[model samples]
Target chain A: MEKVTININGADYSAEVEPRLLLVHFIRENANLTGTHVGCDTTSCGACTILLDGKPVKSCTMFAVQANGKHLTTVEGLAQNGKLSPVQEGFHEKHGLQCGFCTPGMMLTSVAFLKKNPNPTEGEIRWAISGNLCRCTGYVNIVEAVKYAAEKMKESNQ
Target chain B: MIPAQFEYAAPVSIPDALALLRSNPDAKILSGGQSLIPLIKFRLAQPALLVDINNIGGLDYIRAQDGWLKIGALVREADLEDSALVRRSYPLLYDTTLSVADPLVRNRATLAGNLAHADPANDHPATMLAYRAEVVATGVNISRVIPIDDFFRGLFATSLAPDELLTEVRVPMPKPRSGGAYLKMERKVGDFATAGVAVQLNLDAAGKIEQIGIGLTNVGLQALRAKRSEDALRGALPDAKGIERAARLAQEDCDPASDLRGSVEYKRNLVRVLTMRAIEKAIERAKGM
Candidate 1:
């Protein structure tokens, strides 16, 4: 076993982890943050998406040992001071989810996407979330949710 | 899914990493871990030791120097996608980088790892073949340059030795009146190429094809340089007849096996059509249209 310290959502979670332990497992089990879901476990599905040093990456495919000393932002980091983040509010207001299994990953990807491209066209929005799959809502409402978040974030200068 | 247990080491320098690799033949170098970790999780690759190289600095770079575009091993696919130099000057490379898996995967996938993985269906090999690129492989106290032609040995194999690490990739700068394009067809987003073609060419002042390169992806044992097609187009006028002849030659040279993606015949036909379209698009870009 190896000792690793990963900064998740601004809190340092230090633990003794085996080399085979995946980052998704670390976040869910060790840190007790179940917000990041593991859908496919393979790289194809983006359900375990999180921000590593400000870049969105799938956590299931990466070992926790590889993330030592790295800064990660999981879905638990979306809101500020118990208030729902713009993306969370957008999803709720826009009815962006049905099953909601893909909600956390989708919101994390959208948060990172909007930070980069504040004002995205509909085509760009679709392309941005192409990595994160949503079996419910047919992705129409999810697209609307991202648009809503983008507008809100722009207004708040976030 | 959890991967098989292994020992890990994060080396802070190239010499230290090379020493670890030399001492541990069963070690696997981990860069972005986008590809390697998947293999590990599936138990397809169970290395005894993983040499995590992310701690090493000065390797993640994409710069144009000495008339060649240099790409460090740590340069992620997203870096290429975000580079204005790549977008404005290297259209072929730009298209290939953007064609890789997806934005999320591309964020952590390195170009060097893609070529080193040597998967025929991966997008960058065809573009590297078209560019006639070379890779710098470094061992303990020694380094050698291997042209892209000699890089891929077979299916999921490369010329890199167990103790040597691929450090940099070098592509010749595009000359004036030269342009290129990579055309890929996939069943869906984030899927490997069903069939792909990369075409790079230069036009003389008289509008004749000065020199050309064509590469075929996922239609052979490895990425293939269409030498016969390239020979056919060299010094020829950029016209329908010449382009058709070249495309036919490329089709004849590839050897694809039938699978879920498509029949062998369909892939060969796709290659022909994409080759023609790519050459036309390349010519148009070369003329600044």
Candidate 2:
């Protein structure tokens, strides 16, 4: 096993891993961050979304060793002081989930989306979340949730 | 999904990367890990080592020098979309990159990796053929410049020797009056192209077509240059009539195969529609820019 050091959610984390271990597996098994889910080995779905060096990437598509020495922000680390992040709050307020299997990835994706485009239009919101699939809400509430997060993020700066 | 075990080396320079790839037989060059990881998980590839080139310094920039655009091998799709050079000088690449999968994939997927992977359904090969780009590759004492047409030889294959790594792509700047566009038909957001078309037109001072380059993808074992379409559009303005004729020629030049993603007839028809749309958009964009 190769020992690699990584920073997750502002905390330094280390683990001994086989070169074959996927980043999602490392986050879940080694770091004990189970909030990120894996839907497919192919990166077609956004179920394993996480921030690697502040950019959202499908954790299932990346190796743990590839992320060594990089900053990782997973779904479990989204809140601050036990309060929900704006994306989480927005998702909760808008009821953007049903089975909740895809929420963590959705929130992480939303966090990255809002940073790139704080005021995404309806079309942009739909396009931004196209990578993330939701069989439950038909994406109506998810779009609203992203809008809510954007609005809340903007208001917080004032 | 755990990939088979391999040695990992992240080299920060081209020479170091080359050395790493040289020392390890069956070591794969990993740029973005988009295509490689799935191959690893499925056990299609059991590389003994993975030499990651993402950290290769000075290889992530797109620069214009001597009338040719030089895109480093590490330049990510997101970097292409966000790059002012590509957006302003090569809008077709920018538009096509933006249309690939989505933002997250673009953020990690590199242009070199896309071309090196050489999947027939990949959208970039068509655009590269349209641009007449030269693919540069390096291996042990081997450096070659391969034209886009010769780069891809078959389905999911390229001319790149196993020891060679694609280093940079050199694209000549189009003439001042030239314009280009790329269009693709995909079944889903993340699926490969059912068929794609990339059209480039260079107009004379009188707004008549001086030269035309057309490329089609997913209609063959490899992306094809629509020689018939180019022959039809030569010395003609890509007006409605010319575009219509070129679209037919585009379809005539392709031999798409039926697969799970699309039928042969549907893919051939997409070659027509996407070819027409791409040519029209290229002409309109040319007039404006």
Candidate 3:
């Protein structure tokens, strides 16, 4: 077993895990942050997306030990003090989800993307979320949700 | 899917990593884990030990030195794609890096890891071949630089030994009046290329091709350099007829197998079309168009 300490949602949590334990499993099982879903264990689907050191990555593609001493942000971390983040609020406002299975990953992916590209075009938003798959909403509302979040974030900063 | 149980070591230095590899012959080096982890979950690879090298601090830079653009082994694909230096100095590499998986995967996928994994459908091999890049590998007893052409042996195979770690990739600076491009056709977003072509060409002062390199991906056991097409284009005027002839030669050079992406004939057609378009764009860029 390997001992790993990771900061998730701004709190430090340590656990003894097997070397093969994936970060997604660690987040869900050990840390008890189940907001990050595991839709496809393969890297093709972004349902397991999370922020590692502020950059978005598929947690399924990483081992818990690899994230030792790193800061990770999951969908749970996006809200603070019972208020939703801009991305979460935008999803609520734009009806970004239907079945909502792909929302956490989609929102986190957009959080990182909008941090880099705050004002993305419709095409750029589509391209940014290309790794994520949504079977229910057809992605038209997801794009609008990202745009709404971008505007909200820009307004807050101003 | 769960991976088989394995011992893991995170080494902070090159020597320690090499020593770990020497001690465990069946150990696999995990850089980004974008490819290795998925394969492990699928049970396609079952290594007894994993040597994690992400803690090595100096191996994540992109710089131009000694007439070559040196990208450290740990530099992620997203880093290369977003680098201003890469966009300005090596736009072809930038374009190719952008075509890799997607932004999320690119955030963790390393160029060295991608080449070392050596998936024929991956974009970097053919692009590296077009740039005549070299891979720098280091082991306990030796450090050698292997040219891209000789690095890939076959499907998912490379010249790197078990005890050696690839440290960096060095691409020669583009010559004056030279430009390059990488064009790929994928089945959908984030899918591997059905067919791809990377072309680099230099034009002489008189508007003829001085030097040329063409590489094809996903149509062979390895990234195939289109030597026949390159030979046909060298010293030839950049024109429609010459481009067509070279494209035909490129199509003839590939040995694609039918898969979900397309049939052998369809991939060959893509190779021809992409090669022609890449050559035309490269020629136009070479003349500063």
Q: Model 1 over residues A49-109: C-alpha lDDT tens digits?
A: 9999988899997889989999999989989999999999999999999999999989999
**Could you give candidate 2's per-residue lDDT for residues A98-156 as a string of tens digits?**
99988898888889889989989999988877888776888989988889999999999
lDDT of 2 by residue, B3-83 (tens): 667888888877888888778778899998788878899899999989998887888879998888999888988888878
Cα lDDT of model 3 by residue, B78-117, tens digit: 9998899898868679879999998899999999999999
Quality of candidate 1's docking, in CAPRI categories? high
Model 3 residue pairs with clashes: none
At residue B237, candidate 2 shows an lDDT of 57
> Against the true two-chain complex, what DockQ does each candidate achieve?
0.89, 0.78, 0.89
At residue B218, candidate 1 shows an lDDT of 94
The residue pairs in collision within model 1 are none
Task: Candidate 3: count the clashes.
Answer: 0
Cα distance off (Å), candidate 3, residue A147: 1.0
Candidate 2 has which clashing residue pairs, if any?
none
